[model samples]
Target: MRTTPAGGVVLVGVLAWISGVLQLFAGVLMLVAGDHPVTGWLHLLVGLATFPVCLAIFRARVWARIVLSVVFLFEIAAVVFALTDLRFLATPAVTSAVLAVFGLVLLYTPSANASFRQATIDRRNRAATAR
Candidate 1:
């Protein structure tokens, strides 16, 4: 019998998806601005990458959880750097960092761990059965 997934992970996943969508929108805006092509492209790249991570997390993939943790780490770093000079953007930067932290914390809860572990086993079993 499969256990119900923890609510914390589900909330985190939804937040992550919302973040990814926001990034995609921001990337499009930057691209339209046509000031720094590289930055815009990087945003687009990260935003695009976030979708798969979001999907994997909902599916209880452990690696996706790890990847998201690392991503949030980078996000926190980015916000710190941005805060140094971009005072006008401080609100958004801090908000992003806080959400990242929240996601990271939820990703490590006991229920979240069990959900991911079970998913890993299920994935392995399916793979073996297919072979």
Candidate 2:
């Protein structure tokens, strides 16, 4: 399971973790401040999902790339929706949107993609050579 660590991925992972914690905290705050639970629950779910993803990214799991890519797209859509309603102008939402964009960009960069691909190729080659 050992894989070469990509610095960009590591940086992205840290940012993801930070954003997740922020979202989780915001969800709690919203829950306490509100009469409704649905919105808070959604934020909580999104936040909870992010912790595992951050770990996966750090480990350079191939699936991490796919999962993060999808999550990025989802968040972008969410941000757009929020912006349309003027709900995304708050400090935390704006910050999370920016961070998510940065993480997505880094993950999709050619260097990051090549590193992950190389890791996969090397692992297969090693396995085949061993056999």
Prediction 2 global C-alpha lDDT: 0.71
CA lDDT of each prediction against the hidden true structure: 0.69, 0.71
Q: In model 1, what are the clashing residue pairs, if there are any?
A: none
The per-residue C-alpha lDDT of model 2 at residue 39 equals 57
Residue-by-residue lDDT tens digits, candidate 2, 18-43: 87776676556556664445655655
RMSD of each: 3.3, 2.9
**Per-residue CA lDDT of candidate 1, range 47-111, in tens?**
57777888778777778888888777866665554445344534544565687788899999998
Model 2 deviation from the true structure expressed as Cα RMSD, one decimal place: 2.9
In the predicted model 2, the residue pairs found to clash are none
lDDT of 1 at 127: 81
The candidate that wins on lDDT is 2
Q: Give Cα distance to truth, residue 122, candidate 1, Å.
A: 1.4
